[model samples]
Target: MITTTGLTKVYQSRDREVTALDGVDLHVREGEVYGVIGQSGAGKSSLIRCVNLLERPTSGTVTVAGQDLTALAGRGRRAGAELRRARTRIGMVFQHFNLLDSRTVLDNVELPLEILGVSGQARTRKAKELLDLVGLAEKAKSYPGQLSGGQKQRVGIARALAGDPQVLLSDEATSALDPETTRSILQLLRDLNQQLGLTVLLITHEMDVVKTVCDSAALMQRGRIVESGTVGELLATPGSELAHELFPVGGTASGPDRTVVDVTFHGESASRPVISQLSRTYNIDISILGAAMDTVGGKQIGRMRIELPGRFEENVVPIGFLREQGLQAEVVDGDPAPKTPAGAPAATAGPAGTTAVPEQTAPPVKEAAK
Candidate 1:
């Protein structure tokens, strides 16, 4: 539904030129949620603004629903009409609630329709329906100052949809709220996306937000997309920095008798009992250090750390077996020895010495598919 080719945006200060975007190419398929994540000054906000020509790009082209936005540079009434029509199809929700204190909840929701010239009866019906959809039907008469943060944001969502837009752009919408509120808003967004068939372009710095709702996410660094894919694929690529940020590994206290390794599971392989098999096949005592198992996009996947025996040398064979089964296993630098223990210390060493591994992080590599 949305496509950008070599999209570039630059800003000129009094003394210097700042390139907010540098020849970035991106495509978002219809009816899918695409997530863009990056550190500060990564052009995430600039990209979202450029999608609707809110911030005109320095060069390149943007096409949405087959309309060339860059070419709509007309003047007077004609340009205004064309841009209005385009914007009506593209909705945006800001991080700040952006509601008027003087307006009631229903009034805030109805403002967009008022701007599009939607009349009295039609606007009232649509506004009530949207408020109901967002579960704020009773708040229609209340002003923005009276509502909670989540409620105010719901009003924003309802207002964005007042035009019945095909594409919805979210700009760090949950950055201001607490964790519980953030989860609630994320669930609301997922529900709306599925129910309305709206294509969403969500921009956020939080990895949990992406993990909770996005089908595919791209990591932006310094005005460019460094990595992009399904979350599972990214996680399985050994030491993917994007995946690491999404699901971080806990610390592993190294001992004299154990080794640490990081393992990734995805697709059909993610469902198998490979961890148990490692011990059963090699007769190596394996102790699970730390593991995180979750279903992303309804698919089961896992990232785990297992400890091997300190005497475990020559991991080429066991690691090879994991690869043969279509799993990603990386031997990290650590010893599973207990604190101040030689042989059979209070640490117990868990199982066999063949595997003593803690789950500390490893260098990131692009995970290969199952």
Candidate 2:
């Protein structure tokens, strides 16, 4: 388990001070894979580095596994021996595989143990076991250049685990690889988390990574966590920006007078035919504008945008009916029209002077859950 209270990190520049983290309070539960997702320059990297005291916070406290890491990290440019010993319990995997070209795969894994004064035979035995754990036992004699990107990362993972850490910190570990490799790496992290009961705190900009392996997630913006919760809680929230970003359902009402509503379905509701039931029960025709569906943590989740035949006032009963069916339905007022391509023909007006726009395709959803 990990907890950070009022964590703040400020960088000193010649001209101005840059605040990477601003009074952030974060908590990661034991044995849970927690994800921090944000765009570049959102302080994700700074926060993770601060967790291990690689970048000491300007202020606040960091507690990991019931130990106050911030207290152990005294005010000094270099870490003392006690702090160094404490860091062995926290493992870190980098985006770029930080393996030495001069060292073989087994040697790379043994580096950490060697630093801890592990004997030669013991280090070799531990490194080989780790190599086998990461499915790179046959590559022990190969150099870094001889391995693929994914293999090199496996070596990095084995090296990190040499310390037998209780917590694993991943800093964009899959960003450099291709999509297939990324998926494989994510799966490996999930496997490691379950197999070793590792408390994983990974920071990434990719929503697919969070959806795939995170038990809970926090969204960072401008060095602040704007939203944090379980994936199901986010999807069920009526106006959650993270939910909209995760499953982007894009569409607009063909006419301004029509009632447009956004609906979210999760858990048991996701498998039910709620839309058809709403249509048949109310004896009203429903036009689906767009929808996105995916599985997270082995549960199906979906978001949909639909249009009704009347104004918002007239569709109140139907919307209430949808809510009764365990759906998060909210009216979208004054839905913006879809933007046309430059020099493209304009949409023609339909009957009753309403512009007719074709349905927009929903964004692709990655089926990342195992």
Candidate 3:
């Protein structure tokens, strides 16, 4: 329900101009969790801010829920009444739970409704409902200072929902929480997306966050969108950086007689016995170097690094065999047919199709999958 065209944002200084977003085009479908990921300087924060006009774009458009936010926000830095009204339909969650310490959990949730001129009784009732929805009803009477980090975030989520927003923007909301808490918060967001039909736009530097919750994702680099697609589409793509980061493979050089091949599994292929079938068909033993299996968007997705008892050229037929079974297979490392005079096979690194194991250790595929 969100779309941007030529969304460019530039910062001006005395000497130079810096562009946080350059000709960025984005589309987030309704009721889906779409993640925008990048490093510290990737302009992810700027993009999220611009979505709600928190950071006005130097040029371009921002449209949400069939309203062109750029047009609603006239030429000034101050927000007009129209823009303010439009913003009420959008909710935002921050990395640091920005709760008023003096206010109780219930009041924190009620703040948004209060701003909307909701009556005291109605706001309290609505706040309680939101708290219950977020599993924080019991903490309604407690102050923010008394709650744990996760609880505070839960309060933040409850407050964001106070306005009954159709769209939710999460700005590193779980970055400050621990891993377990992060998972819980993400699950909560997922549940909200499904139950309330809330369309979520997530900004995160963590790949795991995207892997766990995002239905689709886009990678930002140097103020530009380098890649964007569904999780399975990206995983099946050849040399997809997003997919490689999603399932990192440690590459280790094997003995001269073996060739390393990476096999990518998506959807139904993930359930098939392709590895064993390849061995039986080709009459070659396969060694599992590493594997990473993950469930995203209710689909099984994963990658595996395997070693064949021959050079890469010799195993071409087997790699092709994997492709016929709806799997992506690529040569990770190995030599041509002829071995070097020193009896050492020349190392060849191809595009990544699976997570590579570290050179120092061969972490078993099962453990790696976990």
Candidate 4:
């Protein structure tokens, strides 16, 4: 469990001060893979470091395992024996697999135990078990210089688990590896989260990485959490900046005469016969422009971009029918409605750079019940 209230980090030079984090708040439940995602300089790394007090916050409070991090901000170097004991349960893995070139794989894994004052026989046994756990049992005798990128990271993971941490911090752990290797490492992290019940904080810039492993994710911009929710929930959010970043729907626009609507469906409605209903009820020719399907937290989910023939004015009935089916539909293109809905502005341009027909304003809604 980790909680941060208005967590902030500021850095200073002679000329000026820059705020990396500004009143950020985070709440991670036990045994969940909570992800923090953003582009470079979004304060993602700074937030992760502040978790275990690796980076001292300029303001705000951080509480982990009941220890107040803000109270110990300036005392990181002198966090004392009790603080050190607490930190032993929080393991951190870096982007660069920080393995000593001179040390053997087994020795690298043994480093954390050594720092913890773990003795000879028990340390060796624990180190060997961890190496085996990471699928590098034979690599124990090999030095860090001999392993590939993936092997090196496996060693780093093994070392992080040396203290049997209750929480694991992965700071762009797969950024240095290729796609295939990244998949394997993420799979390993997911497996460990489930099997060992270890709470994991996965920080990355790649939406695919978060999509592959994170159950819930937060989008950070300007050191603040702009969006936070389950991956499916975020994906279903209409006009959400985070959703667009995760699933970029930009592509060639349809002919000027056509009408485009981005239909988002999740849960029971995802597999329902809504697409057919549109054709049967309205009897309009429809063409699917693009579609993507994925499982979020082991639930089947799918979203499709569909286009209707003729003009937006003629497609009004079909769009309303989709809404009744528990789907989110937006008029992505074509002429504005004859009249704008009360309190709703005229539609703007969509990713395809085509005119988006304005719609009657509707409040946000949750996913359909199971």
Candidate 5:
């Protein structure tokens, strides 16, 4: 639904030139939720803003729903008529709620339709329906200042949909709220993506948000996308930095001789008991370090760090067995080690209900599929 080629954004100061985006190319498929993630200086904000021409790019092209937004936009900072009209079909939600404090919730939502010369009665009816959709119909008369942060964000979502947009751009829409509120907002976006068939392109610093909602994700660093792909593909790639970040399991290891391996499970492999089968087949005890399991878009995606009672050579057969079963098993610990302590369970739950592994970081890689 959205594509960018050589998308670069450069900012000029009196004595310096800074590039926020560097020859970036991205593709977000239709009817899917695509997440852009990075640290604060990673150019994540610039990329999303460029998508809708909110921050006009210094170079490159943006195509959405077959329309070239860059071509339709004016050469200057101000958007042209065609670009303005095109934007109506592309809605945006901000990190801050960006609501009009003076206007009531219903009035705030009606503003977008009003700009299109929609009649008062028609816009009012449409606004109410949107408010109901976001579960805020009863608060239509309340002003922005009177609502909680989550409620205000709901108002923002309702307003963004007032234009009946086909694409929704979320700029850290839940960053300001608490964890519980953040989950609520993310779930709402997921629901809207399914109900309206809206193609969502959101940028966030939080991996949890992406883990919970995005069908695919891109990782940005130093103004370039280092990784981009479906979540499953990322999980399946060994030493994927994005995958590691998404399901972190950092801690001190309890044993040095134990052979540790990180395994990724997705698709059919996620349903199988590969870990247990490995232990039974090899007759070697397995120790769980850390794990993260999530059901995204109704698919089970999981990453686990496990330890076997031997060196890499001794466990090669079991790892190969796991690979033949469609699991990505990479040995993280290779040194030979003593057997598990007496009476220790084969595995224990770690953070996020997955076994934990000590921190072993790596640089993010671009999606091979891209």
Candidate 6:
């Protein structure tokens, strides 16, 4: 488990101070894969570095497995002996496989154990076991240059696990790999999490990574966590920016009188023919404008934008019907509606709603590691 409270990291540039983390309070539960997603310069790199005290936080506390690392003595860049020993319990996997060119695969994994004064035979035995765990046992004699990108990352993972850490911090570990390799690496992380009961806190810009393996996730923007929760909770929340980003559905009202609403489906509701039921039950035609479906945390989730043949006021009961069925339905485009009926979910206004979905943009380039 990991928890950070009021965590702030400020960099002293030549001219002005750069605030990388702005009072971020994050919690990653034990034995769960948590993901932090954001574009470049969103403090993702800084956050992970702070977790291991690799980049000391300008202020606030960093707690891992009930230990307050920031409370340990040792000032300056170098950590104290106490902090150093504590770090051995927290493993870190980097985006770039920071392996020595000259060291063989087994040697790279054994580096941490050697630093810990592990005996030669013991180190080799532990390293080989780790190599086998990461499916790289046969590459023990191969050098860093001899392995593929995925294999090199596996070496990095094995090296991180040499100390048998309880927590794993991944700093964009799959960013540099191709899609296939990225999927494989992500699957490996999931496997490790399940097999070792490792508490994984990974930061990535790719939503696909979060969708595939994360039990919970946080969205970072401008150095702050804008949204965070269990994947299912986020999808079921009304007006959740992270939910919209995770399953984006685009559409506009077809005509002036028509009302457009966005519906989120997950859990039992995802498999039901709710749309067809809505159409037949109300005897009203429904036009689907846009839809997206995907599996998240081993469960199906989907979102859809649909149009109804009336103003928001006329469709209040119909919208309420959706909420009663355990679906998150909100008016995304429609004329202003009256006060929602008692016990009925409120309908948000049209494009003029409080939160308008932003246009999709290309993924930003990965930021330089801080």
Candidate 2 lDDT score at position 274: 88
RMSD of 4: 5.0
lDDT tens readout by residue for model 1, 185-304: 988889999999999999999988888899888889889887887776777655566876776565463575556767778888888888787676666777777888777787777778
* Structural similarity to truth (TM-score) of each candidate: 0.84, 0.89, 0.88, 0.86, 0.86, 0.91
Tens digits of lDDT, candidate 2, 1-370: 9999999999999999999999989999999999999999999999999999999999999999998888878756564676888889999999999999999999999999999999999999999999999999999999999999999999999999999999999999999999998989889889999999999999999999988899999999989998898888887765677888898887877886787878889989999998997777667889999999988999888899899987765665566667667887766656453344454344433322123332222122222111
lDDT for 41 in candidate 1 is 97
Q: Kindly report which residue stretches of model 3 are placed more than 4 angstroms away from their true locations once superposed.
A: 75-79, 255-258, 333-370
**Which is the winner by lDDT between candidate 3 and candidate 5?**
3
Q: Give the worst 10-residue stretch by lDDT in candidate 1.
A: 361-370
Which regions in candidate 2 have their CA more than 4 angstroms from the true location?
Answer: 75-79, 335-370
Q: Where does candidate 4 clash, by residue pair?
A: none
lDDT of 4 at 54: 78
What is the C-alpha lDDT profile of model 6 across 308-338, one tens digit per residue?
A: 9987667766665677677888777444533
> Which candidate gets the maximum TM-score versus the true structure?
6
Q: Lowest lDDT 10-mer window, candidate 4?
A: 361-370
Considering only N, C-alpha and C atoms within 3 Å, which residue pairs clash in candidate 5? 257-337, 289-355, 289-356, 290-355, 290-356, 291-354, 291-355
Tens digits of per-residue lDDT for model 5, 141-179: 999999999999999999999999999999999999999
Error of 2 at 287 (Å): 1.0
Candidate 6 deviates by what RMSD?
Answer: 9.2
Flag clash pairs in model 6. none
Model 3 compared with the native: what TM-score?
0.88
> On a 0 to 1 TM-score scale, where does candidate 6 land against the true structure?
0.91
- Evaluation by lDDT, superior candidate among 4 and 6: 6
Question: For candidate 6, which ten residues in a row score worst on lDDT?
Answer: 361-370
**lDDT on C-alpha atoms for all candidate structures:** 0.80, 0.85, 0.85, 0.80, 0.83, 0.87
